[model samples]
Target: MRGLFLLTLALMVPGGVQATLPPPPGGPTPAPRLVSFAPPPSVVVCKGGEARVVESAPIHARIWQPWIPPVIGRAAHQIPPPPAPPTADIYTFSIDADGAVIDLSRPMAPTMWPGDEQAAALAKWRFAPGAPIKGCRLDLAPTTVALS
Candidate 1:
């Protein structure tokens, strides 16, 4: 009887059945899920004019974040998507005499915006005048539909 029961149990179990199950319904797809992130303050302070500040940030083209579907978007898109991911922005910030963030600038390229949201969000930024920026705090938050 014991031998018979053991055989029955072995037959019931599927051969090589993967123990791990797929993602739950309405869950994120297992895609490449590309995410690019730069630690806060890529470029610190530069003692030149405004032009110098812009030069400090890596002025190049590179993907910042990869967007996924809504369910997986937030999870995969943890980093802030560049106006144009994979493309570096001509980023610059200025502080007033009081060390408050006064002027913040990010030049837009053709790739920056697929829609109007990017332009609008970038324009609305207001930094404290003369804000003593110890590092490059570009787009302090994620640029998304909700935040933008």
Candidate 2:
């Protein structure tokens, strides 16, 4: 009776029943199961506050009188520019994630102040990479900044 029972049990059990899928046409499929999958969380750390000025551009442009001859002596060398009208243009700009200055614009640029030169100078500025910031103000000639 015991020998018969053992033989019956051994024959009933299946041999090497692997829980694997059929090979796919692309390649053998990976056996990883995505049970309750939640993607990893990401936190964006932004740098803010005042942007330090590393390289500074001169805000003043000197004027030289070409008509004044060399006979005028040292006085002809450096001629101070005429006083600019009380027109201050505030340039608005932002910094990108790569710390490069972007979105530079001056709504009402003064005639004497070259907007292109000032904007180009600001564009080359690179600060610490950070989140998007708006409402940054820069007084053109003075180069005063209120960056956030």
Provide the clashing-pair count of each candidate structure.
21, 0
Superposed Cα deviation of residue 83, candidate 2 (Å): 8.6
Tens-digit lDDT track for model 2 on 1-148? 9999988877888783458754333322223221111221121122445654444344333232122122222232354433334346567777666666678788777554356655666676666556655555666433222121
Q: Among all windows of ten consecutive residues in candidate 1, which has the lowest summed lDDT? A: 51-60
Error of 1 at 148 (Å): 25
Q: How many backbone clashes does candidate 1 have?
A: 21
- Model 2 local distance difference test score: 0.48
Stretches > 4 Å off in candidate 2: 1-49, 54-60, 64-84, 141-148
RMSD of each: 13.5, 31.4
Local accuracy of candidate 1 as per-residue lDDT tens digits, 63-141 = 3344434442344446333233333434455544444444555544335334234333433433334535433334432
Candidate 2 colliding pairs = none
lDDT: which candidate is best?
A: 2
Q: Model 1, which residues run further than 4 Å from truth?
A: 1-32, 47-85, 110-148
